[model samples]
Target: MHSRSRDLVEHAVTKVPAVTLGFWIIKIACTTLGETGGDWVTMSLNLGYLIGSLIFLAAFLVLVSAQIRARKFQSTLYWATIVATTTLGTTLADFCDRSLGVGYPGGVAIVFALLVASLAIWYRVEGTVSVESVVSARVEWFYWVTILFSQTLGTALGDWVAGEDRGGLGLGYETSAAIFGAGLVIIGLLWLWPRVSRTALFWSAFVLTRPLGATLGDFFDKPIAQGGLEFSRFYASGILVAFIAGCLLLIPQRAARRAARD
Candidate 1:
């Protein structure tokens, strides 16, 4: 029993990349791909939002299950799961906002509430929301659930701030991207300041990056009349995927060190 327990613990070590510059770069790229890829299936392919959501949700489930079953961090698997969540998030948000007639503000509120609830439940159950503590299956589940919610929330936020229709802010894609990018800069500065929680900052920045990527993706793929570059969603998704592949090959990634437990 003792030997088995030790082995289990050892195998449960962090199965995610160490938080680093490379991680952020690839994360942004993946989120951008999520937006463009989701659009390709739903709009370009004429599948519609509901179908797109179902397809991406299936991918998210499969990838997340694989992630949970893995014994150690596989960069490819981790990133594939992330991309799945983002793609699912994009279509899911669209369904909620447009299909359900909730509008962007309502969709944002719902997803944001879900995200907050997930974090609260995670902290209540695990006593911490730090990614460093994701050394067990239960904690890993919490982490991924929170990520999915946050990703969905980001899509709603991006649409609320940038969508030309649906009573959005009228900022257009590029300006919205710039604003979210500036928010990330502020978060970075806060990270350097003392008396601030690094974990909180990390999650905050993580959430912000999604919307930034979403807006940038829209800027690239939406029509010129819609204040976008009018590029093909398929081509945009392919380029972003190539960029992500290059980053994964060239940049270093390793599972984060396990945090000491009390």
Candidate 2:
């Protein structure tokens, strides 16, 4: 009884935001920013994927460290770290697919494997992979690592589904976005079933959001000839940043709750 009470208390100290509509809204916006912002650095500024990856990786490291050290959640810092991961994932995925000649299919395979491995290791070490269980530093480490792989995998999947006939099915960006959108809707329906596992649904939704944002981002920045609006990557990124900041101000974030009892 004592141990159970103590566990409940610790769970209340979660550092991540509660999974809510506002959370998903901000997350999608951030992922879109990741795509456009990453492209701006890697393509528009001609920095190349390797350089862009390194820059975002550095920022992720610094921000994650600060995040782990924080006694409680800081909305701005937390969201910034998420953006760092998305940007790093963007360039890193590109580096693997284009620079290393892995191709879109290979990049997706490699990153998916890493994501599964990260989750497996986390479940093994922590005995549970619940976000509400992330009150400890060790769990936080696993959480971030899993997110990194998932984000990278998302970029690869998006590119694979939307790329030209050379590597993908040649589906346009709009089609790819619609596909991922449907996936999210399916997951939402599953959530309504009492027999379904919430943890599984949560992760599925999380991963799908990335690809949805990726395709949307591509649609915003690619040339009109290629089915995009041809908007400036810099301009799109700025708009996304403003949208996220505004949402943060409008909706207060709260730490996630413990997963429902098994």
Candidate 3:
């Protein structure tokens, strides 16, 4: 029984997922889905930003609660929670930027600060912000918080860059995607460079990937005149969600510590 219990705990401590090409692919998919998903509820359904925020917020809270309470990582539940956060982050960011009139720059600043603070507090309490140690509930909470902020920031940055008329950097979605893709390449190189901080590189790439997905998502869903594919937000989100679900099903989900086990 003792050995069995230990095995269960070991399973719980297993790493979420390695920062690999596959991880980035799924993450960007989720982020793009987030953009379209949020817009569907807020714009298509005409629930309005406020109502949409409340709906997604509630879903986030519930799913997060379930995620935290689980004894071990369950792929279905975990990814569902991730989808919840991204969708909620999209609506929340949109609310702050448009309804509250914070604008893209203002929203970016606020969300960036929040992400930094969450990381600081996480490191102070947990002694490290590395994804490899996401076993304890406290560290897991910090992880989710940081993710929430990053997702929100990505929304603001995406909007800021992919607009030619909105005082954005005047880069079209394709250009913005390329720029962020280049940034990811740089970070990957740095990760392989001698004496570079792997942790720092990991976080940098993680945060950057969010905006990458956001921009591409907007590009696909926005109007053709605006250079997007003019896809329905709901349809785009649905397809992405289905894809993510398939990956989770086939990818063999495990805890954060599994890789560390000898």
Scored by lDDT, the top model is 1
What TM-score do all the candidates reach, one by one?
A: 0.94, 0.96, 0.89
Best by TM-score: 2
Please provide the root mean square deviation of candidate 3 (C-alpha atoms, Å). 3.4
Worst 10 residues of 3 by lDDT: 253-262
**Residue range 126-183, candidate 2, lDDT tens digits:** 7888787888789888999888888888888899999984377779899999999999
C-alpha lDDT of residue 256 in model 2: 80
Report lDDT (CA) for all predictions: 0.90, 0.90, 0.79
Q: For candidate 2, give the lDDT.
A: 0.90
Residue 46, model 2: Cα distance from true site in angstroms: 0.6
What stretches of model 1 exceed 4 Å from their correct place? 1-12
Of the two candidates 1 and 3, the one with more favorable TM-score, higher being better, is 1
Which residue pairs collide in model 1, if any? none
What does the lDDT read for residue 43 in candidate 2? 99
TM-score of 2: 0.96
TM-score, cand. 3: 0.89
